[model samples]
Target: MLLLALLMGGLQEAGARPNPQALSARIEVREHTARAILFELRVRNDSGHRLTLALGGRPAYNVLVKRPDGTLIWEWQRGQIVQQILEYRSLDPGEELHFEATWKLVDARGRRVPAGEYLVHGVLNLEPPETLVTDSLRVRVAPAKRRRSAK
Candidate 1:
């Protein structure tokens, strides 16, 4: 009975979820101008061995902007075309990969958004083991200044 219990316990431990510290995702935002913001999404491989990631027929990463009240403003994948092919990449230990996009302070409808504080969310989707890592950052957009008419 002791041997049987020990075997079962070993099997259970082997099937447990991967350690959360094996991978990490982070979002960085910087003001490009009074009406423009730059966003960067970074994914890091923290494990000792090389990690393989498969991102299916979609963008490898996604970014979304929302108001403080949680109203969705714009999404990076709204009008993107993703080839119907499986994409894969390998990351060495302590290596990082990044994706970037710039927002012109406009809404999905092309209208300029009001100046205020907004939340930027980013996600890195990995396959094979099917894991999702996410991070967020806050940004402020300054109102555009108007030029006075020449006398």
Candidate 2:
């Protein structure tokens, strides 16, 4: 998993360097559960040009997630997993735009995730969605560990 991340880091760096209006993303997850988890994704306009971003038809921002193998984890575009899209304003050159949202993690049957190791990713739905999905962003989901006392 670390190796994959390393390779992606290099690929993503190259992707973000070329586009003047491109969007770069970094995600930090506070909690992980089948129901939902708190996520703070920082988006920046690394290019030399300033850009405007929107989420759910507003001057806001949202987040999407997928598996490392290119499986669909969750998406705000269809309002499938998450309840609503987090909002944000414009992003200036080299400026940071913090996008916070609660991700609704579910199993194959739409059931909340149990405890386990899963690789969840964040999708940046830029005006012209990013082409480098694999290289864009990746996050790991560490299912909350529960301790049991001996009887």
Candidate 3:
């Protein structure tokens, strides 16, 4: 998993090059149930100065799913409704913010996606300086079990 994370440019070990944004971000597949997959996105302010994020009334972050072949399956932002006002929040050093969502094993068209390995990506989009922080994880969806008929 660590190797795959490295290949996907997701995980960063300690003492690596300091992030220009001074933030740490990561995406994880929290659980996989029969009906849906749960995901968590986290961002932490690691710098000494307070960080202000302007999300522009949309979500502070976005979640995306892609097939193993690199085909996009779903994106959280595509169906979201937001007002046209700027939203801002300040994060003190060592403070963290999180976003969680469940995917119902459906594609962008609302059709059931096939059982397979998919890549989940999270992106923290911030304005003013216009920076983006990203992380990714892989998850597998098992085939649904068949139900037995009444004897």
| Clash pairs for candidate 3 | none
Candidate 3 lDDT at 74 equals 96
lDDT of 1 at 87: 60
Candidate 1 lDDT trough over 10 residues, lowest sum: 1-10
lDDT of 3: 0.67
Candidate 2, clashing residue pairs? 34-112, 34-113, 60-88, 61-88
For model 2, what is the error of residue 11's alpha carbon versus the real structure, in angstroms, after optimal superposition?
Answer: 29
On residues 60-132, what C-alpha lDDT tens digit does candidate 1 reach at each position?
6778899999899998777888665556677787888788878888888978888898888876554433535
lDDT of 2 by residue, 1-151 (tens): 0111111113223323333335556667777564577876666666556554443334234555656566665654454353344333455668875656776666445655554445544444432333212233545555655669799
Instruction: Output the lDDT of residue 60, model 1.
Output: 67
Global lDDT of each candidate: 0.67, 0.49, 0.67
Task: Report the error of model 1 at residue 141, Å.
Answer: 0.7
- Candidate 2 residue spans exceeding 4 A from truth: 1-22, 31-35, 52-56, 59-62, 76-90, 128-151
Q: TM-score per candidate, in order?
A: 0.78, 0.50, 0.76
